[model samples]
Target: MDIYVLVGIVIFLALAFDFINGFHDTANAIATSVSTRALSPRVAIIVASIMNFVGAMLFTGVAKTIGGKVADPAKLEHGVEIVIASLLSAILWNLVTWWFGIPSSSSHALIGSLAGAVVSAEGFGGINYSGFTDIIKGLIFSPLIAFTIGFIVMWLFKQIFAKSSPHQINKGFRTGQIITAAFQSFTHGTNDAQKAMGIITFALVAANLQSTLDVPWWVKVAAASSMALGTSIGGWKIIKTMGTKIFKIEPINGFAADITSASVILTATLTKLPVSTTHVITSAILGVGSAKRFSAVKWGLAGRIVISWIITIPVTAIIAALIYRVIALFM
Candidate 1:
């Protein structure tokens, strides 16, 4: 393949992953709204997609952090092979999770695949300890933070309106759900689209195609456009799992969960940490459910989700390793 054509193909694959990221995780931002009838499923997805696009345009720091600060691109001497392996691994995992109707993290899958391919390509020396450490910390802390916030918010709402009528409370929270869901969608764009942008920018650098660490405008446009398009398509299968399987979502609980997830995600973005919105929201929902009653949380389903989370990185990494080896033959 021509060098230019190879680059284009890599870029397109990255964008495809971004689109899948948006669609696959649409449940994180809008599932509760759709379930509570606060927004029809179609309308909710449209609104979420718009906010996701806007969020992507507003946050560029994440792309910089991943592309430049993470594993160095120069180490990826086999740039095309690296890109192909990473994206194929992530896409495969995304499809697997989606088919199972489990909400796993696309962000984590991408990172895991990238790490695996980089390690395979150049051995341990190619890895960036600093970047790896930050992501590890995020993987642990983001969900905990979201869970705490979710618990506190739900508890506070209950305490404050101890005597309020159920109907009145539900009405107020239904309105609140719109705002919080939008926040989640915005934060989703800010954090997630950057993963795709980072991959594309890193590819450019590795291929000696770009001059600086700065990602080109075209990269951002492509990443954001693909993610938004994916969000518009929505993920109804996972939506059922998130909106109803873990817990029966009421307006109040949904509002609290969305608020908690959104706040944690946006804060992580500002710090340039790429945490999974799926993990955060899922944890938040669990926290809210636990607050109602320990049994209300459906530990079985939660366990399944956690198992998926644990497997996502390693499973995708293994797949990425295989992909790298396969592509090496072509290269």
Candidate 2:
């Protein structure tokens, strides 16, 4: 097969994975706003879709990280095969989680797949320990940071509005929720789509389709567009989980959690860390739920989600490794 043709296939698959990531995680950004009747389902998805595209244009720091820093590309004997395996692993995992109405991290799936492919291609020597360790720091800290900030912001809002009339507080927070939700969606685009863009660009280079690290303008447009279109489809089942399962989200709590998730994700993106928007926002929601009372959170269900998070990386990694091995045997 021609190298350019092979690279093109990998890029398309990567964009497809990005599309799944956006649609699968749509519930993360708009669930509360929809549940609280701040926006109708149609309006919420349309608004989120626009913000998602705009957000994709905001930065490329994380894209650079994924394309250039995580693993040494030279070590992979079959770069195109690795690309296919990694993207397929992410896509399959995203579908599985979506089917079960659980919000898992697409970001972690890609990282794990790439790492697994690198190891399979050429032992641990292919891994960039410093870059890999930095990503690990982000994976561990992002959700914890988002949870703390969400809790504090929600608590403060409750304290300040304690004396306000319910009508006034509700109106104020309804307006605030729109702004925070938009911010979260924007952050989502900036971080999530870039991961796909990076992988596609990396594949091009690996297949000798591109001579440099720079991503083609067409790749950016396609990646961003796929994510935006996917967001428009929405994820209703997971929306129910986030909006109602965690706790009864008032407008004030919704606003706080959105702001907190936005802040953490934006900061992580600037630092070029491939962090999970799903993990960050879900952690914030759980924190808000726990703030009211421990019992307010469905601990059993939350525990299950945590277990899913724990398994995502290894499961996807093994899947990707198997994919590469199979492809090598046939191709």
Candidate 3:
């Protein structure tokens, strides 16, 4: 394939991955608000779409980290092809998880796929151990942090509202959920939307069209637009899983979960680290549920979700390595 043609294919696939990510993770942002009747589905999707775009347009640090941190795009012999395999594999995982209504991590799929493809193409030496380990650390610790903070936040809310009427507290918190939902969606954009941008930029550098990791203007617009459009579609199945299955999310519980997850995601973005919005959001809900009443949480379902998270990296990695090997036959 001509280099230009290959690059074009990579760009297309990257944007497609971004689009899938938007809807796959959409539930992370609005499920709580919608479940609590703080915002209707239609209004929630619209607000999430707009906020996602705005947040995507405003951040590039995460993109830079993704482009260079896992593996050096410019140093590989077939970096563009590695990126193509990574995108395709990640997209496949996202779709499969979405179909099953599982709240899996698109971030994990992408990062793991990219790392696997790089290793397949260049051996273990292909990876920048320092950078890659840092990324992994961020992914590993973020959900734990979100869970802890979620517990504390919900604990505070419970104490503060103990003397108040339950109905009155819920009525007030329902209104507050709208703002937190928007912020959650915006933070989602800050982290998730950048994954595709990074993948595309990785391809550009590998193709010799760019020398630096700085994202181009057109790339930003295209990625932001793709994510916004996807967010508008909504993912009702995943929304059901996230909003209701884990536990009963009253307005106050929803508020605490949203605020906790959003803050964690935004902090990760600021540090130029990519965290799984799915994990953070779900963990926050779990933490809040525990604080509300430990037994009320469906521990069996939560255990299954955790199992999926544990396997995503290795499964996607093996899948991407196989994909790269298949592509190598043509090369």
Candidate 4:
């Protein structure tokens, strides 16, 4: 097959992955608002879709990082094939976890798959240890930071509103969630949509169609549009898990979680690092729940979620590696 043809296929697959990511991670943006009844599902989806599109178009630093960090696309003989395998493996893992209503990280899936596919094609020596470790550090620590920030934010909320009537406070935060949710969705767009753009640009670079890590405008538009469309479709299953599984979310709690996670995510975007919005938002919710009352959280469910987080990277990496070997048979 022509490398150009393969590049075309990669483009399609990258958009498809973005679309899947849109719905798959959509829950991260709107779950709290929907759970708290701050916004109806229909309205929430609309808001998220628009904000995600806008956010996706506004940045490309993370895209550049993703394009060049895992392994230099220019250095590989079968770079396009590796991209195909990586996308296939990432998409497969995403769908599997989505089917089970697990809020797994699309970021991890893509990063792991890219690493696995690269190693499969060029051996461990091909991997960019410094860049890979920097990305991994962002992914691992962002959630912990989000959790701590969420706890402090909730604690502050409690302290400031302690004298207020509980009913009135809840009512006010319920309305405030509208703003936070929109902001959350925007930040989600900025970070999550860029991953697909990065992969597509990586493919372009690998195929010798481009010279730099710069993301083309067309790439950004395609990625952002795909993500917005997927967000419009909504992911009700994950919504249920994020909204009410780990803890029963109230308006105040939702507000705290949304703000904390959004801040962490947006910070990562600005720093050109890819972090898991799912992990950050989920951990933020757990922290808020804990601040509300440690005993009130369902620790079993939180444990299950953490387990999923722990396993996603290794599992997806192995899957991508095997898939790459199978792809090599035909190539």
RMSD of each: 1.0, 1.3, 0.5, 0.6
Those runs of model 3 whose alpha carbons end farther than 4 Å from true positions after fitting are: none
- Model 2: residues >4 Å from true position, as ranges? none
Q: lDDT winner between 1 and 4, please give it.
A: 4
- Per residue, candidate 3 scores C-alpha lDDT tens digits across 2-25 of 999999999999999989999998
Query: Can you give the TM-score per candidate against the true fold?
Result: 0.98, 0.97, 0.99, 0.99
Write out the backbone clash pairs for model 3: none
Q: Which stretches of candidate 1 lie over 4 Å from their true place?
A: none
Worst 10 residues of 2 by lDDT: 68-77
TM-score quality measure for candidate 1: 0.98
Report the lDDT tens digits of candidate 4 across residue range 174-201: 9999999999999999999999999999
Tens-digit per-residue lDDT, 1-331, candidate 2: 6777778789789889988888998889898888888888898898889999998877777887888677755445688778888898889999999999988889889999888877776677878899888887898799999888888877887788889998888788888888888888999998998999889877877776676667678878888899999999899999998888878888877887888899999999988887999999999988877775668789888888888888998998898888888877877
lDDT of residue 70 for candidate 1: 51
Better of 1 and 2 by TM-score: 1
Could you tell which candidate, 2 or 3, scores higher by TM-score? 3
Candidate 1 C-alpha lDDT tens digits along 1-331: 6778878888889989998998999988999988898888988998899999999988888887777665888766786678778999999899888888999999889988988988888787888988788887898789988888888888888898889999999999999888887888999999999989988888888889885668688888888999999999999999999999998989999998998899899999999888989999999999988886778888999999999988888888889988999888887
The per-residue C-alpha lDDT of model 2 at residue 129 equals 92
How many Å off is the CA of 223 in candidate 4?
Answer: 0.2
